[model samples]
Target: MEKAKAFLDKLTEEEHERVSRLPFKNDFKFYEDFALLGMHVDLVKPGLVSCSFKVPPRLTDGNGNLASGAIANLVDEVGAAVIYVEGLPMNVSVDMSMSYLSTAKLHDELEITSRLLGRKGGYSGTLVLIKNKTTGEVIAEGRHSLFGKPASKM
Candidate 1:
């Protein structure tokens, strides 16, 4: 974590400001939920990232269950957050495939970890896994592909 923080600290002021202005970081709802759930940026690299999200009641769906969409959103956010923190311009999700391996109830804290798998030109890919914090069970997994040039290219 300290290493990641040090990496982030090296960003120029202009770079940091550009990243902070990303839609995911600036969205009030996303920011509020990330803060409320105790989500933290743990590690980040060019195409890899890991973060954790604490499940709270407010994140549950209508069936009193943790919605798969919510899980997907968490995965996407953490994966994208990694790129943003690295001072890269925001990329758009071109495709996202998800599978719900298990169900989670309210208050079930989750750790969402993602890694950049590969990239070709302006296209990049990532893999994400959502695991149960207590039981260490994998509740969900996903793969996302993003399309966009690097921020510096813009």
Candidate 2:
């Protein structure tokens, strides 16, 4: 366990230095821009969407597996895309529930798919699944709920 401790100590120091130099500004990046940086949209329909992404080193955790936060970000982005319309304001995430079934390693190709569950007025729900493309292993699943501006009745 000494090796693990040494590794952790080094990574912690690096992260500490990185965070200490941070200055808050409007230049902050959104989750979509960061986590979906390398994502490629494959297919899209009114209530369904599919994407292809290779697990990048920048999105991996200490164990070399895809970071859980990255998976969650993907869920939010892809889930919203399934229902997004041109010229419409983006929906805001209300709640998200996720189940991490497996881990994805660096350079592993992933297939992400999202499907609409149902909608009510201004609220919508969707389900997203992330899986390793080669091994067909399921990586994660998320249920996302979002709220948008209500449509006009006229």
TM-score of each: 0.69, 0.78
Query: Model 1: what TM-score?
Result: 0.69
Assess candidate 1 and give its lDDT.
Answer: 0.75
- List, residue by residue over 7-70, the lDDT tens digit for candidate 2: 6577677787885564434464654455677789899888999999999887999999999998
User: Each candidate's lDDT (Cα)?
Assistant: 0.75, 0.89
Please give me the total number of clashing residue pairs in predicted model 1: 0
Summing lDDT over every window of 10 consecutive residues in candidate 1, give the lowest-scoring window. Answer: 79-88
Q: Report lDDT (Cα) of residue 67, candidate 2.
A: 95
Q: List, residue by residue over 1-154, the lDDT tens digit for candidate 1.
A: 9999998999999999997875454446765455345676677667667776667766688877788778878767765654553455678889889998998888777777888787777787888898988999999999888877754545
